[model samples]
Target: MKKFVLKPKIYFNEGSMEFLKEIKGSCAFIVSDSVMETLGYLQKTIDYLNETGIESAVFKEVRPDPDVKVIAEGMKKYLETQADTIVALGGGSTIDAAKGIIYSLWQFRKAAGEEFKKPLFIAIPSTSGTGSEVTNFSVITAEGEKVCIVDEWMAPDIAILDSTCIQHVPQSVVADTGIDALVHAIEAYVSTEATHCTDALAEKAVQLIFENLKALYNDASNSCARERIQNASCIAGMAFTNAGLGINHSLAHALGGTFHISHGRSNALLLSAVVEYNANLNSNDSRYASEKYARLAAVLQLPARTYREGTINFMQAVKDLLKSLGIPNRVRELGIDKSKFENKVETMVELALHDRCTPTNPRLPSREDLVGIYQKVF
Candidate 1:
């Protein structure tokens, strides 16, 4: 009994932004971060939207790791203009802000007795990761905890994947975000909830990412790599949204909330450790888990002759990938002290146990298991 939903009308190419002019809407509000505005992408998006004879407003205050306060403020701006549609431009932050605004607006309109039309959101991702455009999940910080919003209605109406949008991204961003997309594919492929549909998507995503992530990291202007990574991100997003993620994301959320670490880097630090932890649980003839490691190792061109060897090689490959991307490999390398991490380990474990994504994990952890995993990463 596997059912899923991926309802976005996507347009991809060099100039898909031109499609904005044909969308029927009264006004289009854009949600973005300061960096996107500096790059002139936001203005370009608004100019095209206005070509449709639609009025537009820009809410360019979406911060990195956007919080509930920011979402509430953006919603107030949305209400002031009574905008009927939204254009999210930039990376994960901008697309995430758009989701927050949509969720808030839905509630407000319902309470005010207005037509509760779902805002028409068109996402133009400027990076090749997070795949926030295609999925209905939005992670917003509330009271220092990252919370997931999972309403199917929050999925964007249109997703524009123009690889040219990522042409000017910094090398560091290219490396971090690219690894994040690869992690998404690998994690979802091994998920307990993974269906045939998700497995197909995840396998393709993994193949594409391994083929192009390094090229993109070294040469941002490589158009071929850009397109491949862009497609990989969307595929990974679709797979993970339906199949769900594992301990890597669960621990990353906690680290991001407590230490204010970058999301991708946090995941980079814990991914291999978490993979090892889960692999250890497959001792009792968990053939599915063993098969997952074998497949992943094969993708990396490793000799996976046995389950234990396969899992070890997979973890080694992940570690090598992060090192090549110049990402820190340990939690302590991020400048956090040991005492603080120890003190907060219990709380982090508790929060992750209740996380929306944890239940679908192939090997659900007990409290002791969570504590042990944290210690291993530490």
Candidate 2:
């Protein structure tokens, strides 16, 4: 029988940070990046914890696309602090790093035959991307490859979405991460593992992204838009966590690992091509993905004279969105040498084919198929 699981009680809205005050803990260890510290968000979180009589410590070493070394270091800090509570405050990287640290700590204790109580894991997202707060997936770079680790224990116990913290995010980040949320929704919608539950969340998430992303991108201070997109990100995350992802993520992970492209930007760069590839009616034996794409187009209110037309319109819309956001559509446009990409193309394809996300893709991609897709986008 198929199963669906939900955890991490989510708190959102203007005063959502107050939820921290209610958490039962003596000490809290915060995992975040230097940027969050620079923005004073770290201090703001600590202040909340302090109000609750909870002592706190901060580890501000997380970076974009955090690696195993960073996780190992963070794990060390977690142990040293021995905080009863762990709060991850930042984007995907910070939340993912926090999860990795906690996971590592659990494994170490278990391996040593030592009793360990699970820390109260809380994820406070500073950006409306990745939705790592609600998901068990963590993408850590290891030896120049993005390694996806998923476990029930990795999911945060609480997810606090405070739009106040995200209001000052850069417009470029808004664009990159907004598109990433859209991709998450789309991939989940078309995943072979999708159910009515996942599809409902994915459909709403996609609609919210389409309606609010551009507005947030144009005016970062629009609280309504910001809130919508933030919720959309979490909604999409919930959808993908249950439905599973597809080749879009697999391809993005491989490309990001090899070229050091930012995760959201990498996903945005590959979106149109991946959609077109997935929507191919002639080669794909199954009509399920194509129908799902058509449904998504319908949700966006794009004209759908036929399934193919709807699918094409969806692809064009993605392309248009990328252009408007100043995102490069081709990998070469991002300054990678064409010859070098070609040389690494085979290796990337192999990595993607073996990615955990690939198995759930509606259409099974062949080696040649993946190569062609990469070449076209390159």
CA lDDT, every model vs. true structure: 0.84, 0.90
RMSD vs true structure, all candidates? 1.7, 1.2
Candidate 1 structure lDDT: 0.84
Best by lDDT: 2
Where's the lowest-lDDT run of ten residues in candidate 2?
280-289
Model 1 / residue 10 / CA error / Å: 1.5
TM-score of each: 0.95, 0.98
State the lDDT of candidate 2 residue by residue for 92-111, as single tens digits.
Answer: 99999898888887888899
Off by over 4 Å in 1: 111-115
Q: Model 1 over residues 1-378: C-alpha lDDT tens digits?
A: 888788899898788878888888889888888887888787887888788888889899988889988999998898888787888998898899889888887878889987767777889999988988899889999999998777788888899998888899888888778878887887888898898898889888988987888888888878998999999999999999888888778888887888998787777778887787777745774667667877778876788888778778877877877888888767887788999999999999988888887877778789998888788777
Say which candidate scores most in TM-score: 2
* lDDT for predicted candidate 2 compared with the true structure: 0.90
lDDT of 2 at 77: 82
